[model samples]
Every structure is written in C-alpha cells, then in structure tokens.
Target: LPASQQEHIFNAAWGGSHKTGQLICNACNQSFSTNVDEVFSLYTTAIMNAWSFKGQRHKSVPIIELDGDYVLEAGAKLRIKPEKPLFEEKNLPNGQIRTKISFNSKGEAKRWLNNGGAESWLGRSLTPEEREYLLSLIKESEPQRREPEPQEASTTLNLRNQYRSSAHTILKCLGFFLPDLVCSPLTQPIRQFARYDEGDWRLFAVEPEQFFSLGEEITNLLGLGVYHNSVEIYWSSSSRMIVGILTLLNRVKRAVIISNNYAGSDKILYVFEDTNLSKKPPTAILAEIDSSKFCQPLLGVQYFAQPTKMYEYFYNELVGLTSIYNPIDAMKAELIKSLEEVNKHHTTLEGSTIDQYQTLYLNFFIKLGKVLQVSVDSVKIDSKLQEYGFSRLRLELKGRNITDPEVESIIVQAFDSVLSDWTQNRL
Candidate 1:
C-alpha cells in the first residue's frame, strides 16, 4: 500500500473511529503463550475499564473571576477580605496547602455564565466568620448525614426520582451497568460509603442555594445526599471508590448527579459502557451490592484542570481567603454603589404623569430593597432617585397603560444593570 493510503487506514481505524484500534504484534504471527496471554488479558481489562467516549461532549466555558467582594443581583455589595486565615495549619491535613488564587474557564462554568452575566460572581470568598454566617443564611447548605435505616424495599426508580430509601437500588443500577466497577474494589466490603447524585455535572462546587438561586440558568441539581433535601452524603470510608465509578458511567439526559462536590468538578472520563444510546433504552438495574453503602445516580461527573483538588481550590482559594465586609455602616456602601450604578445606566421614566413615574420608580426600588434586604420607604426611594437626577417630569400618554408587567420588565432590567456594575467594581 502507498504511504498515504496506509496513513489514511491507520487514522480511520484508530483516530476517527473510537470503537476499534489496531495492535501491532512485534513477534511471530502465532498466538500468544499462556503467560503473555494472561498479561495481555489484564491489560485489555484495564483498557476496557478506562475507555470513555463521552469526553467528546466536554465543553469548557469562561470563568467568572471573583477577585474580592461579592455583589448581589439586587445591587448589594459585600466586601470580603478576611482578617486572618480561616483555618490554621493544624486544622488542615499535613502537607495540604490551600489552592492558589487564579482564573479559569472550564466545565459547568459554561452553563452558569451562559446568560452572559446573570448568574456569575465577581468573587466567591468569605471569612471564616462569613462562612459561618452564610451557612446560617442558607441553612440547608451543609446537612449532617443521617444514620441509614434497615435496607428497605428497592425500587426500579430512574435516576431522577430516587431517594434515601432507593439508595441500594441506585447502587444496583450502577453495578448492573458496569459490573467490573464493583468487582475491582479500592477498599473492601463496599457497604460503608454514602452516595450522592449530581445531575448535569458542572466544574465548580457552588452551594445548592446559590446555584439554584440562578433559577433556570442552573437546570440540574447538585448533590442530593442522605439528608432528604441535602446535597452531601456521609458513609463509611470503605465504599468511597464506588462513587468514582459512578462518575465514570454514562450520563443520563435531564438527570442530576449527587455529590458534596459540584457536578463537573472533575475531569469526566467517558467510559464507552454503552455506545448505541439512540437505539437502546437507558441502562437500568436492581440488585443489592452492600448493606451498609447507599447509592445516588449521577446525571454526570465533574472535572477541572485538577479534579481531585477542585474542592480544596474552591474552599481555600475562593472562599477561605475572602471575608464578607458587612460594615455596620453599610448605608454608605449601598448609597454609593447604587448612586454609581444609576449614573452609568439610570432608568428613565417611560410613562406619563407623576403617578405613572412614581409607580414605576417605586416598584423598581421596592424590588431592589428586597434583594438588598432593606425596607423600601417610598418617600426615601423617591428622594434618592431625585438625587440621582431621575426626572419625575410627566410625558403625554400615547401608548398602552403602564401596567405591573411593564414596571416589572423595567425594574428587572435596571436591577441587572445596576447589580452588574456593582459586581464589576468589586472585582
């Protein structure tokens, strides 16, 4: 064969087609001996265990750099600069250093930032005190794992609807789909680990409350642990490797993976466990793996440049080093942030008459007040708008009535614009 034809054949067989590859035997054309066959068999097993094609869909998105403070969607600014280290060296494991501060765009960030700037943060850091405070703010952020009840009746529930009672069923499903995973145990007696399901895996580990707060921007739920509404699962250490195998399994569309870490926080290894996805129904199973361990199905797994270290990076580099500078005198911060915001993209009165203007302006401030967690005194808000040069000058009524819907549209847009500015300044 000509060299070009040979090259074409090799690329077509190995590179273009993931289903097959050519192995060049160096020795004679005869079949392998027993010892060599054994070694090769194990090699093929390892290869089969690690082979994945889902990597083709891995799309990296931009990172929203939270350089310093956190700004809310309602234009509230939180200056986060920690006064001291959140955790001392003794508190962390020996030789475990905090991840360094840096910017990145990979994994779930693509989905989070897909709205351009709606669900992003300039910074995500918090002081130890702020971290505790935020824990209180979002009460369900960290849930304690509950003791597992007696192995209940397992169900044939799909990945989306499974619960604590269905954990064993999920494990069975995992084992059914990929039996080799259960056979090769990193730790013995696989019944001791807890399971989580994160649907539509993303890279960064944002708390459920914050991630969900983005509304439609974040479609799938991250980690649903043992606590019924919680996202973290605590199980015995022995079966931990099972979760890693679940991450390697094929992703189910529209389902979430449960985990302490955010979905897509790890580099996803696409095991081509089943390739004929369009033709075949999704893989399902029902068999008990271990009595002590629980399982939660994953929509998919997460990955970053460094998968294992993503949690550390988020905690230490993003949240630990930053403080929530909630000053007792936040009035000035609020006033200035809002003032600066209005100057850039101030709202104009689109309705005629003082009543229309007042209604629209009042509604905008009221919306803002809720986000800033402050009272919207109508008089004070009017005065503030006047100070920012928003004219209450009436216009002639020519178009449709300025209803609540119009006011809502105007206010939401203004809120996003002002908040975007406030957040940009903090960064």
Candidate 2:
C-alpha cells in the first residue's frame, strides 16, 4: 500500500493476506469475492487496460498510454471492504478516500495520484518506447496485416461456395481466417459492428462505408463464425439483419458483445487475434481474445506504465507457477502461510528487530518453500542473539533445476501448458 492510495472504486490489496474480502461495484451492481489481491489485480489490470487502448489511433505501431479519461466517470465508486466485520468503506488517516483499502489499518494506503502524477487511473504515463514494448507484451499469437480493403463481397451461391472452399484451403494452409470489423465511418452492418464491444479498454474507429462492407466481406469470405472446421450459418428476421448478426456473433465471442446496445461506430475497431499457418485445427480456428479479468481495467490506467506494475505483471506471467489457471494466487499464497503461523506463535515481529533463533527459524521454514516448489524471496528474521546482535534472514527466490530428469520434464510440460492457456494469441 502506498502513502497516498485511495479507491474511488476499490483498489484491492486483496491477496497479500488471506482473511477473504468483498468487491462491490455499485454501478455494475455486482458483488463477489474469491481472494482480495487476486481479484483486485485482475480488476485493475482489466479496467486500466481499457483506458490504455481506447480512443487511440490504430497505427502500425502502438502508442502505449492511457486512452485518456474517457473511463473516469464522476461518482463511480467501486469499493472493496472486509466482509468479516461487515463491509466497511475505509478512509485514510488524513480523511482521504482510501479506495485501495488496506486491511492492516496502515496509514500508507491511499490513492495512486496522492504521490503526485497524472489525473489518471494509474497516476502516471510511460515513454513511447516502453509503451510500445508493453503493448507487444499482450501476446498476439497471429498478427493481422492491413492490405487494400476487399470490395463488397458478393455471396451468390457460386461466390459463397468459392469462399467456403477458400476457407477450407486456408485451413489446409494451417490457420484460420479472422474478420475484425473496423466501424469508424459507419456504413455496412453497423449494428453488428456495434455488437462487438471491448469491455474494459476502448478501441480505434473505422471508416464509415467499411461497416456493412466488412460484414459482407466476413459473410462472404469466412462464412459465419466457425465451430470446429464447420462454419456457423445464421440468419434471423428479428430486429434487422444487423441485430441478428450481432445476436449470433455474441454467441461466438463475448469480448465483442459489450456496451449493451451498439454505440454508433465512432470508436470501435476489432483485432483478429490469431491464425496458425500450419496444422489445421479440426475445430473453428478461433481468433478472438478470451475475456480476461487481467486485461479489462489495467490497460486503461497510467499506473500500468509504472516500473512497479511492470515487475508485478512480469512476476506473475514469467514467474508465477501458481496464478495462471487457478485465478486465485492460491498456490504461492498457500505456501506463504507458514509466516502467519509463525506470527501467531511468536506474536510480535515488526519494527527494527531481529530473530534470536536464526538457525531454528531457517531450519523449520527452509523446507516450506521447497515443498511448495517456489523460492522464498527474502525472509526477514528479527530479535538479537546473544553476541551476534539481531540478524535478518533474507532468501531471494531462486530457480532451481529438479534433480530428477523425468520429473523435470513433467514440470516443464505443466508450465508450458499453463503458459499456452493463459496467453492470448494476438499480434
């Protein structure tokens, strides 16, 4: 927690300690909890991400910065409170709003801006190069290239058959075709284009005539969305073809179905996430980002540009052996718990002190992190021993090779699987 942390909407320090908590979004009318730190991280990342990408130009290169203050609506209060003693909206010592409320009752926890920065959700900005680098971190498995726009696609039986054949041929080429509609100028299938929304972050806009034209191209080019190698053909008279197209596309990708009703095409552009050029999938060549709790908010804020956030995200993605699929930082956290148990028995261990029983403490907790298979990064021991004076126990997280070769292979495979699942195939 920082000295100036605050939560207009709750900035959850949720997972650091394990008492359990609550996140209540009054505007969204939603309240839920799993672990505090995990949830808050996910929320911050997702929401801030929206601010990062929204309203920016879709240049060949990304300008990694906040999408401006489009998301900071006044009067929005996302609060996280201690569910144990009944939910309470916490306040800072100086009576400031501590939106990222802390359970420890520490004076530091306040708002990101209190330390002096931008009028931003994350309170800071990144340089052009760094921002571009972070945007690349978004893992685009397949990068989409822009070419001269294809003409209005004609779906005559012959053309449809040819397109269908072309689709299969592309599959044989070992990848799927993706249809990302850029609805800036708003011409064709504007309604269906509107249906595709980016929830947390915002998007760049498309030219007007490009709307229905893109929809027509998608209708003719890839058929409808795929389900396995088979394409999904949908047509309904309900609400216009625009509404019908949206209704169907919603079932195909939830990430595109935000904003309830389409908000005219002044500000939305879709990215076709992936397509492999080898080994055709037997199923729909899926090429959309799965709705991520991590991406929703963080991209929208300036804080994501900070060094601290960079380290935190890196720690999770490259080093997190626990949080990927589990969502709850449970594994790393579960292993950390020995400290709490020690805290109970030993009672007090804070301030400038040293542990007298250095050897005993190390010997007992030494096997703890090893058992969990994650390194313990710097453990502090307080209390002065007889002549040596108070000593600190510092253990930096170290990556070690497992002694057994076969077990090492299995661990590596598990790690690979986790990485594959968590990473979005976007470019």
Candidate 3:
C-alpha cells in the first residue's frame, strides 16, 4: 500500500493521539471497521457513557437505553421515555372518577392533552369548561417522581468478529511498532486471519488472571487511572510468541497472539491513553520483557475449544466491571472508600466533616434503596433498630470521637448486614 492509502492502526474513537501514522492499508482498515470495529465501538461506548469516559470524537455523553421506559444519560441520570401516557384510574366511594396520568415530562402531557388525549380517554368530545379544568388540574398537580433501577444495556456481539478485530489491531500495532516482524512468514497466519478471514485460528484470549495482573502493572507505570485505553505488544521468549493485549476504558480486555513461531529477541511496546482527554496524550513506552517474570503459557491455534471460554470470560468480566450490572456492590465499594477517606483525613469527625460524611452516606443509601426496590422516602436512618445495620451505623457514629480500629470493623459489619438483607430479596 502507498503512503496515501495507509490508515491509523489504533481506532480514532479510542482518543489515542498516535493515530496520525500510516500503519495499515486503507482497504484493510476500512474492512475491519465495517466488519468488526463498529460493533466493538458500540459495545465499548455503552460502558464509556456509563463510566463517563470521554473520547476524542464523542466528547459529549451518548444516551444509552435501559430496561423498560427509561434511558440512561451520560452522567448516570435515568430519564423515563414512555412511548405513551400512562394512566391509572380508580372509582372513589363518592362515585367520582379519580385519574392519574404519567408522561415523560410535563410538556409531553400538555402536548398530548392539546391533541385531544383527554377526550379520547373520556370517549367523547369535552366541553370548553371540562378541557380547561383538566388543563388546570394537570398544571396544579405535582409530578410524581420515581427512581428507575439501573440496568445494564443489552448488547449482542459477534464473537468471531470481535476476535478478528482484536487480532487485526494487534497486526496494525506490529506494523507501526515492530515493522521488521510484521511481514515475516511467522506472522502470515495472523495477517491472513485478520485481513482475509482465511483461518480458523484462536486469535484472542480473555484470561482475567493474566490480564488483571499485568494490567495493574501497566496502568501503575503509565499513571493511567481507572478508565483508560491501552495496547501492549511484546515477544515472549518462553512461549516463543509475539503477543498483544488490547484494553478499552480499562474494562474490556483481549489478548491476541500476533505470531506463535517467532524468532526474535525480547521486544515490548506499550501504548496507552487516558480516556479523560484533559489528562495526557497517547504515549508509547519501550521496554525489554524479562523471560523469568513472564511465565504465561502460549495460547496456540491448536486450542479449538478456547473460543467458547473466551466468550464467556469476556462477558463475565464486563458484568463485574460495569456498575449498572452490579450497582449494589459498586455502591458498597464507593461507600467504603468514602468512609476510608474520611477516617484517613479527620482524627475525629465533626462539624463540616461530619456533614460531608453524612452527605456521602445518604447518597449511597438512596442508590442502595433503588437497587433493593425500596422507595426513596423509606430510605431513612431509623433509631429503633438495635442491630448495627445500615440505619444503625449512622446512630453509632453520632457524637462519637471514636477513630480507631473499630471503625473498620463497624463498616464491615454494616456492609455484611446490608448484603444479607439484599440477598434475602435476591437482589
């Protein structure tokens, strides 16, 4: 391919700064985008929107669909988007009809009413007096507020396409970073599989144990916080394979085999970018892989059954990482972190500090209530309970200058009790 026909190795949607280079041919790059990158982008964007990971192109939060008549916005705000007005009618004992209406917004209700919504429900044309009265009632009545439970957006992905896309990226990374080995005979299998879809090779693996352990080390070194995009390419001497790992928003992970029968010295190229655009630009790190430190077994093409395991493991990791799928645990972890921060800063919580802690506590409780299917109004710290549970924890901390080891114990106990109660409801 000529220079003009070359395309970016890293997807620009990932907000990587190193996208300027000519790494792959335009035809092959466009093919990957059409076949696999689009679906991969959609899958990652849902998580990115939920976690607020801003990309280069998608600077604004994209609206994502949730369960029922709700849609989740960028900042985790759930907005109801009912297709039609919901009404609940009851016969009062005084022979009067009591009606309640629900709409996505007050404006929607007005528009529906203006377009003869009320008359259709009444089964007759309304008089001027009745129409005016209904409008007045709608204006005066306070809108009922209900919190929608957070649910993970459902996504259908072609596993074969995902595997191919991952391998294609690895090949592009190789072309950009390790040009010498990219066109070698050993890499032909990967190239053919990624570009032409000519092989039934196991192109990728989703081994959480290997991914997380190495991911921690890479993130720590790069100072890329919780949500970031990363790609690592290295030659494994023990396995005699050139491997690549791709991570998006620090959540989606894939390990791709670039070449299994490589004859090269140890080489490492780690590229990463913080999804939060304000922090840093894309960076490339060079290092040598120590054979002793890298003992991960090579995943060769002979393992035909590994693809099924990879699919299962990928979804399992996704569910655990996304907060919507596991809000209770997410909230619990956040609450624990908040308490720990408070304990670390203040010797004895008082005044504004106490207020801050209470604010965090209340916010957590409100979310927990929604997850538990309990109304927000019922999420209160009742003093009648003797057990040191959610409600009792606040009372236990009141006016106490206790900032010792017992604080941790109390937190653990409170979380355990809450978990027990939550599990009782099968939440």
Best by TM-score: 3
Question: In candidate 1, what are the lDDT values of residues 1-427, reduced to their tens digit?
Answer: 1112111111111111221112212221112221111221211111122221112112221111233332211122232322321222333477665432111222222233343321223265445674455334333333334333222221122212212212222333333344443344432222222222223223222222111111121112322111011111112123222232221111111112223322222122211123212222222222222323324322223444454564464444222112111121133234434444543442443443334444555665565565456665677555544433333233322242333345434434443444454345421
Per-candidate TM-scores read 0.22, 0.17, 0.66
- Candidate 1 Cα errors over 4 Å, as ranges: 1-192, 195-215, 218-308, 316-403, 425-427
Per-residue alpha-carbon lDDT of candidate 2 for residues 1-427, written as tens digits (9 for 90 to 100): 2213211111112111111112112321111122111222322232222222111112211121223212211111112222221123667799876432222122121222233322253356756674545345333223333332212211112212222222222211221222222222222232232222212111211011112222334444543321111222111112111111111111111111112233322221221211122222223322222223222321111223454764474355322321231222222233224334443454333221123233333433343344344443323311212212222112211122223344233323433343242233210
Determine the C-alpha RMSD for candidate 1 after optimal superposition of all C-alphas.
26.8
* Pairwise TM-score winner, candidates 2 and 3: 3
* Whole-model alpha-carbon lDDT for candidate 2: 0.25
Cα error of candidate 3 at position 129, Å:
7.6
Winner on lDDT between 1 and 3 is 3
User: Where is the poorest 10-residue window by lDDT in model 3?
Assistant: 377-386
Which stretches in model 2 have alpha-carbon errors above 4 Å? 1-365, 368-389, 392-427
RMSD of each: 26.8, 26.3, 8.0
Residues 133-248 of candidate 3: C-alpha lDDT, one tens digit per residue: 87887788787787665455666767667767777766766666567777789888877877787776454443322422444587865546545677777665656777777876
lDDT ranking from best candidate downward: 3, 1, 2
Give Cα distance to truth, residue 29, candidate 3, Å. Answer: 2.6
